[model samples]
Target: MGTLDEIKAALINLDIPQVQCKIHQGLAEGLSPSAILEKSLIAGMNTIGSRFKEGDFFMPEVLVAAKAMHTGLDILKPLLTAVENRVKGTVAIGTIKGDLHDIGKNLVIMMLEGAGFEVVDLGVDVPPDKFITAIETHHPRVVGLSVLLTSVMPQLQTTIQQLEPYRRELYIVIGGAPITQQYADKIGADGYAPDAASAVDKVRELIARN
Candidate 1:
């Protein structure tokens, strides 16, 4: 495999040490931080995401792969901080109240951070008031809402309504197994991502349009 693909493979196999070594080698070989991130780490996680959706992989596999990806990210994050590498944007994300699942939300965080967006994770079981507070305090370019249960989907609308005062200033994106594009549109959300990989693309596209 090519060096970049090797990074992806290491993450797929959940090989953290290999991921660390490969990422360092990529840097030593003069590859840009963003290139390693987008082409390797994030791309690898995209594969993991597909496997997860297909049931070839489960939560344990995804969690371990996320750890492997982070091993590489830990090494490269400092380089991305260089003045020449300005952050692409900022995001605040969390699961709505009554939903305790956070594995998907954490995956999105790694992917967003890898893609060079400064992400502020609002954690699981977050109330609409907390999301409102996050927007007011962080002044993020986008806010993401995650819901794992269809029963709690109403909280998504409630959270969006609470943030309506800042609607013109920040974009709101939603996701989770229970969240559909139609539901997103129904709630008047600015965007909806089907998975973590697409979340990166969606966030970037939304930011670019504004």
Candidate 2:
């Protein structure tokens, strides 16, 4: 297999050391940082997300793979310095009020950053006004809402509804263990991601549509 393929495999296996090493190899071989990101790190994370959706991979494996992706990203990031800060697009993300879970939020942020989007993190327990403030401040192309609790689901809807004034101005994407496409549709969100890898995909799609 090729060095790029090796990079992808090391990431899927969650081999942090190998991932970093392969990234170095890719750079030495003259592979562009964007090529390394799309072909290796994002590609591997996409497979992990598919497995998680199919119930073949669990949270521990997903988190480990995320770590491996970060290892590779740490190497590629500096090389990508010129375009690293949102040449792709900007996204404002946060966990809704009363929901403190961030593992899912953090994973998505990692993937977004790796994909070359500048993320304005709103942090956890964020209110609707904070969302609006971020929208006004960053003028992000997408706004992401993460909800980990079934009870806090209403807050997600409230946040979305409260942002109706900005609906025409930006796209909204929602994700978390408790979040689903159905819930997203019901709450009038623009997109839904089932896993961290797909979160990047979803944002890409949103950017295209926007």
Candidate 3:
């Protein structure tokens, strides 16, 4: 198999040490870091995310694969200088207020970073004011909210309400277990992703439109 394919397989296997070594070897062989990320790390995570959504891969499998991806990213991070690391756009993400769940949020952050966007993760149980502060401070092209609990859907609404003034220029995306496209639309979210893989695609689409 090709180097990229080997890297992808290693990532799926959650072989962190091997994945890191292969990424280094690929870089030495003149493979671009961007290519390695897109073809191997992102590709593998996409597969894992899809499997997870389809119930073919459980949380443990996805978590391990994500860990392996982080290992490879550690090796590539230094090679990506400030200018090279400046991707298509910046995205700020957080789990909405009063909701502490973060696994889904973390997965989306990883996928976004893998897709080349600089991500600012605001962590879980974030309030509307925090989102507003982050948007004002970071000036990101897009913002993402994650809410796993049905109880926290109102928090998503509050965040969107707080962001409506800047909604014309800022793209807002929402996701998590209880969030649906209908709920996203109802809450005035620009986009909704059912899973991490789809979140990558949705963010790309949002950036393209912007």
Considering every candidate listed, which one attains the maximal lDDT? Answer: 1
Residue pairs whose backbone atoms clash in candidate 1: none
Residues 1-210 of candidate 2 have per-residue lDDT tens digits of: 998999999988888999988888888998889888888888888888789889999989988987887777788776686656436888999999999988779878977887778899999999999999999999999999999899999998889889999989799999998877887898789999888778888899878874
Task: Score candidate 3 by lDDT.
Answer: 0.85
Ranking by lDDT: 1, 2, 3
lDDT of each: 0.89, 0.87, 0.85
Task: Tell me how far candidate 1 lies from the true structure as C-alpha RMSD in angstroms.
Answer: 1.7
lDDT of 1 by residue, 1-210 (tens): 788988889899988888999988888888888888888988888898889889999989988987887778788877877733788888999999999999889888987887779999999999988988888898999999999998999988988999999988899999998888999999999999988889999999999996
Cα lDDT tens digits for candidate 3, 74-183: 77765654436568688999998998989878878876776678899999889888988988898898999998889778878888988998787779999998888998
* Model 3: worst 10 consecutive residues (lDDT sum): 77-86
As for candidate 2, its clashing pairs are: none
Against the correct fold, how does model 1 do in TM-score? 0.92
Candidate 2 Cα errors over 4 Å, as ranges: 47-62, 81-86
- RMSD to the true structure for each prediction, in A, is 1.7, 2.7, 2.5
